[model samples]
Target chain A: MRAAIRSEWTKLWTTRTVWWALLGAFVLMAAAAGQNAIYVENGDVTTASVAVMSVTIAQLAFVALAMLVMTGEYSAGTIRATLSWIPSRGRLLSAKIAVVSAVTLVTGVAVGLLGGVIASAIVDDSGSIAGDAFKIGIYLVLLGALATGLGAALRGPVVTLVVLLMTIVVIPPLLQLPDIAVLNGIADAFPGVAGGHFLYGDADPYPPLVGLLILAGWAALAVAAGWQVLTRRDA
Target chain B: MSITLEKLTKRYGPTLAVDGLDLAVRPGRVTGFLGPNGAGKSTTMRMVLGLDRPTSGRALVGGRAYDSYKWPLREMGALLEAKAVHPGRTGRNHLLAMARSNAVPDRRVDEVLAVVGLTDVARRRSGTHSLGMGQRLGIAGALLADPPVLMLDEPVNGLDPDGVRWIRGLLRDLAAEGRTVFVSSHLLSEMQMTADHLVVIGHGKLLADAPMTEIMGGHATLEDAYYELTGSAA
Candidate 1:
C-alpha cells in the first residue's frame, strides 16, 4: 500500500499537467469570484453561494486532472509497468483512492478556502457562512474521489469527462422536468444534486445527511466499476 | 526466476491474437520471442505479465502467476514497450518512481542509467528524448530492480547500431549472471546474434521453441528456420 501511494505521488508530482490543472483551478476560481463580487452589487446571490459558484467551474478542472491521472497511463501504455510493480489489483486501487482523495481534499479545501477568502474581501455582506462549513470541506473531497474513480473505470479522458459532466451538469438540469418530477426526484437524489446542498443552503431540496449518502453512493458505484474494469481488462 | 507459458490463448472478439501457444524460458539463457506484425507476440507477453487475461491456460513465473508474487519486481523486469516512462518526467525521475515501488535503492537509478549508457542524458525530460534514448531509458528502468527474469519487447526497435550492440552485450552479460532474459523482436537477423534460444510464433500460435543451434541445424540460419517454422516461404 505504501509503495502504491509512493508510485502515484511520484507520478503526480513529476507530471506538468497536475501543476497546470491545479493552477487553472485556482486562477479560474479566483477570477470568477473576483468578477462576481465586482459586478453584481445588488444581486440575489448570497456571499457564500457566490464564492461556492466559482467552485462549480473549477470543479471541471479538478475532474479533468483526476481523469488524466489514470488516462495518461493508458495513453502512454504505462499501465503494464504500474500493474507489474503492484500486482495485487485491489491494493493498487485502494492506495490510489486514498492518495488521490487526500491530495484532492487538500487542493479542494485550499481552493474553496481561498475563494471564500478572496470573495469575502470583495463583496460587502453582513451574512456569515453557514455553521456546517466542515461538511462543505468533506463534500469537496468526495467530489474529487468520485471523479477519480469514474476516470479510472472509463480509462479515457473524453469518456470520463463526458460522464462526469452529465452527472454534474446535464442530469441536474434534466431532473427539473415537470413531467418526470417523481423520477427527477430520484435522479435529484444523485450525488450532483445532493452535493449541491453543501453550497446552496436552505434552497437545497433534501437534507444534508441524505445528500451526502447520495454522493457517497455515486462514489461507491464508480469505485466498484473501476475495480471491475481494472481486474478484467488488458492493461 | 524461470518464465513459462503453457497453452496460452487470447481471443479478441472473433480475432485470435494468441492461439494456444506454449514456451519455456530457462535461467542463464537469452530467449527471443519472434513473430510477424500482428502475430500475437505482444499479446502473449502481456498475458505472461498478467497485463492481459488469457482466454485459456496460464503464463507463470517461478511456478506461480505474476499477481500471486508478493514482490514481482524482484522476480521479473520487463520493458514491454519503449516510452513506458511518462513523457512529462525526466529520465532519472522516471526510474526513481519505479524504483520506489519495488523498494529498490535510489542509487540503482544512477547505476542502471550508467549501465544503459544514458547517464549523460539522465536529467533530460523523457518527452524530449530520442526514440533510441527512450528505449535505453526503458532498458534502464527494467534493470533498476536487477530481477532474476527480464522480459523486453522490441528492445532494439528504434536503436542505432551502437545502441543495439550495447543492449545485445548487456543481455548476454545479464544472462551470464544466471538470469532469464526474454526478449521479443520481429527481426530474426537481430535475434540471430543476441538470442540463445528462439520461440517463433505466427498468426497467434507457437511454431518453434528450440536452441539456436538446433533450429539452425534444420535450415541455413535462424532466419531460414524462422521462415520454415512460421510456414512462410519468403
Candidate 2:
C-alpha cells in the first residue's frame, strides 16, 4: 500500500494535469467568492452565504480533478501497465482512490480557505472564517472525492463531466420547483447541495457533518460501482 | 519464477477470447507465444498476469496465484502490451513511478535506461517518442525489477534493425542468466531468432508447445510451421 501510494503520488505530481486542475479550481472558487463579496455591498445576501459561495465554486475544481483521476488512465492506455504491476485489481483501485481522495482533500482545503479569505477580505466581512472555514474545507474534499469516484465508474471524461455538472448545477434548481419537495429533500443529499449547506451558513435540512456523510456515502457507492466494473470488465 | 495457465478460459458475451488454454512457461529460457489476431494470446497473458479473471480454471505463478505473492514484481517483470505508458510523463519518470511501486532502488532506473539504450532520450516526454523508442522504454521498464520472469507482448513491433538487434541480444542475455523470458509476437522470423521454445495458439486454443528446433524440425521453416498450424483456423 505504501508503494502504491508512492507510485500514484509520483504519477499525479509528474503530470501537468494536477497543477492545471488546481489552478482552475482556485480561479473558479475565487471568482465565485468575488461575486459574493459584491453581495455584501448590495446588502442582498448574508455574510455567511457569501462565504459559502466561495467554497461552492471552489469545489468545481475538485470535480474537474476527480474526473481526470481515473479516466486519464483509460485515455492513455496506462491502466494496463498499472494492473500488470499490481495484479490485485481491487488493491490498485483502492490505492488510486485513496491517493486521489487524500490529494484532493489537502488541495481542496487549502484552496477553499484561500479563496474564502480573499473574498471575505474584499467585502470587509470575516464571517466565521476561523470556525466555519475548516468545516467548509472538509466539505469541499468530500464533494471532490464523490466526483472522482463517479468519474472512475463512468470511465469517460465527457460523460462523467456532464453527469457531475448536471448533478451539481441542475439538480438544485429542479429541487427548488413547487411540488418537488420530496425530490428536493433527496437532492439535498446530493454532493452539491450538501456541500452548499456546509460552506454557506444556511438552514440545512441536515447538519454539516450529515451533509459530509451524505457526500461520502455517494462517493462510496460510486467507488464500489467503479471497482466492480474495473475488476469484472476488461481494461 | 514460472507461469502456468491451466484450462484457463474467458468469454466476452458470445465471443470466446480464450478457450480452455493450458500452458506452462518454465525458467531459464525465452518462450515465444505466437498467434493470429484475436487468437486469445493477449487474453491468456492477461489471465496469467492476473490482470483478467478467467471465467474458469486458474493462472498460477510459481505454484501459487499472482495475488498470493508477497511482492509480485520481485518474481516477474512484465510489459504485456506495446505503448502501455502514460504519455504525459518522461520515460525516466514513468519507470521511476513503477520502481517506487515495487520498492526498486533509484539507481536501477538509470541502469535500465542505459540497458535499453534510452539514456539519451530518458528526459524527453514519452508522448513524443517514436514507436521504436517507446518499445525500448517499455523494455527498460520491464528490466527495472530484474525479476526471474519477463513477459513482453510484441517487444519488437516497431524497431529498426539496430533496435531489434539490441532487444534480441538483451532477451537472449536475460534468458542466459536463467530468467524466464516469455515474449509474444506474430512474426515467425522474429521469434525464430530469439526464442528457444515456442508456444503457438490458434482460434483460442494451443496449437503447439515445444522446443523451437523440434517445432521447426522437417518443416520448411518456422513460418511454414506457423502457417500450417494457423491456416485451418484462419
Compare the candidates by DockQ and give the number of the best one.
2
lDDT of 1 by residue, B139-195 (tens): 888788888999999999899999889889999999999999999987778899999
Looking at candidate 1 chain B, the ten consecutive residues that score lowest on lDDT are B218-227
Q: Per-candidate TM-score, first chain only?
A: 0.88, 0.90
lDDT of every predicted structure (CA atoms): 0.81, 0.80
Whole-model lDDT, model 2: 0.80
Please tell me which predicted candidate would have the highest TM-score against the true structure: 2
lDDT of 2 by residue, A68-154 (tens): 878888888888788767766677777777777788767766665776687667776555565565666577666666666676678
Badly placed stretches (over 4 Å) of model 1 are A38-41, A47-49, A126-133, A177-187, A201-204
RMSD of each: 2.2, 1.9
